[model samples]
Target: MFQNLSERLEGALKVIKGKHKITEINVAEAVKDVRKALVEADVNYKIAKEITERIKEKALGQKILIAVEPYQLMIKIVEDELAQLMGGQKADLMLTGSPAVVLMAGLQGSGKTTFSAKLANQIKRQGRQVLLVACDVYRPAAIEQLKTLALQIGVDVYSEPENNNPVAIAQNAIQYAKANHKNVVIVDTAGRLAVDEEMMNEIEKIKKAINPCEILFVVDSMTGQDAVNTAKAFNERLDFTGVVLTKLDGDTRGGAALSIRAVVEKPIKFIGTSEKIDGIDVFHPDRMARRILNMGDVVGLVEKAQQAFDEKEAERLNKKLRQNQFDFNDFLSQIQQIKKMGNIKDLMSMVPGMSKMMKDVDIPEDAFKSTEAIIFSMTPKERENPQLLISGNGSGSRRKRIALGSGTSIQEVNALVKQFEEMRKVIKKINAMQNTGKKLGKIFGR
Candidate 1:
């Protein structure tokens, strides 16, 4: 997710490594690099320049505030500027009407169908009864896709295969929702390959017929600047209440996310990360800014963790983490918690600095298999405290036996032991920093 742009920005900022103060020269050099990073990431050059100019002004206006360095101040300034660029505040969907009608609009392959399902699931998580309406008449396959997702997620979908008329279908679906006590109706419509008059009229008719509470323009963030243009075209016809930026889980350059809000003057209500029903997230500006700056988004991470965290298990892990007694067993346990939360790479990016380190590295989705096997082979004592496996004691011999039992070499066993040791050290450092600092520490424990 904007990995390349992140690295480029990091490099750009490094140009003033030894500088004691912010100079027009250093700041300009850095801003140029920032603009280049945005452009390369598929941002419109004009929007890119506008953002960099604002970031530059904010950087130059930074007050030292007693002890902060220029570069550090600059990072803070840039984070804020970037946040403002991507919608200064989180915009929520207005699902106010009873049987609230939420209409989706976009170009074909822009993920309108998937996003509709995802949105339904998200609303269901809010404890609302949701009805997913497949109004995409052109593709019978689109109705199948939405139905499959709805069935997989345990949500209800309303479709009129025989009707072919989207506006009438949506009207009947709303009637069905009212009859069935469904609180929200998400109407997914057909999309053209490009913006066309026919597409606009169809969506507009649906809007008029349903008198929807909200109309969202779903655009593929992978298209970068074109995403902004697509949003504009949709907004002109639909007067969409919000925007849905999909495919951010891909290698998007961060351009669309940065420029869409500013250009369309519409709130970006949600983002779609994956095909999974749970892959959708409500847009939050501060959390996203924190993510972009490589500062871990503890708020977002905790929410995810809470959804999957078992109270008893989490408490047990918390005890070990606090005592600095986290070991290979604990590491494996944490990995399991992460895996249950869904995609490993997607969850990993929720942690700030981890993704940068993983950029060039390949983490096989099954990368943890060997670790799991080794842990399964370990005796209770060795799992509890890795010290038993550290030296040539009888326990060491037993661990060697376990390694062979697990069909892994001694080197693999040693690597696992070493990795656990390093993990404990890092966790201890983080715990100390959090406790010592107070605020950011509670985040880690959570």
Candidate 2:
């Protein structure tokens, strides 16, 4: 997720970071490095040059305060320009009609089908009845793929397996949505390996027939410069309402995200962060710019947390923590909640200063597999009362059994038990301190 670009930008900014003041020579040096970094990241040479020139001008024009350093101000200027380049603010989907039709468009293998389902899932979560329409009658198993994804997200999908007319299918799907009381209908159209006249004409017909409120051009962000070019072609014909960049979780150099808006003149409405149905996110240009600069996105992190965690469950956990009753069951529930927040590494990178530290660190998607296995192997009693495995005559035997059941070593079980015990002790100490503070407050009341 722009990891290389982040590092390069950091290095570029270091040129003026240590300087006592800003100067034309230093600004030029840093701007040159910044341009090179953007180019290496697959950004168009012209866009890179233009952005760098703006950065240079802003950097030289700033009246540095006594407290503000050259580098700090320089970072701020770059962040602003980057945000402006990516479409100053987030562009939301316009669901205007009674049964708003959101059409998905893109080349084959660009993730339109997957994004359609993801978008459906997102809208469904918002309490809207979303119907996913499978209009991709060209590609093999395209209809089946959409159905499977729709099933996974528990959303209704409208498809006519026997009908080859995508435009008719889309039209019928909208009618079905209207009759079924659906609020939104997302029509996933067929795409070709390359942009062909037939493909374009078919999508155009679908658009004209449906008169969709929003036509999203889904492009594979991993395609780099080709993504920008493809977007331009599609925008020329369809005049898409917005862009959806997929595969941001892949080895993307981030050229598409940076260049697409400028070239296609369309705001990026959403980003496919991962392959999971819940991995799609609304694009926020300022947050992404901060992330590219390694400044982290605390707001985005909090938003993810809010979406993943339930208020009732959080209150229950808080009560358990206050009473020092946190156990393996509670811990396992916490792990599940964290997993719901998306990729572990991506979540960590959202914390300030963690991105650079985790750049080279390989945190696998299944990092919690062993821990989950160990927890699952434990008996209900042991899960409820973790102290049962800490200080009893049969504790060692219980641990041995758990290790065998979890396919782990006895030493691993011992390490987990020790860590859990330490965590409980810390919780107890915090609870005790809180109680003492309450007592002091009651006694000192005037």
Q: Residue 62 CA error for candidate 2 (Å)?
A: 0.7
- What is candidate 2's local distance difference test score? 0.93
Query: In model 1, where is the ten-residue run with the lowest total lDDT?
Result: 192-201
Question: How large an RMSD does model 2 have?
Answer: 1.1
In order, candidate lDDTs are 0.83, 0.93
- The top-ranked prediction according to TM-score is 2
Instruction: Give all TM-scores, in the order shown.
Output: 0.81, 0.98
What does candidate 2's lDDT look like per residue over 161-248, in tens digits? 9999998998899899999999999999887534588878888999999999999999999989999988888888999999999999
Residue 10 CA displacement from its true place in model 2, Å: 0.7
* Clashes (N, CA, C under 3 Å) per candidate: 0, 0
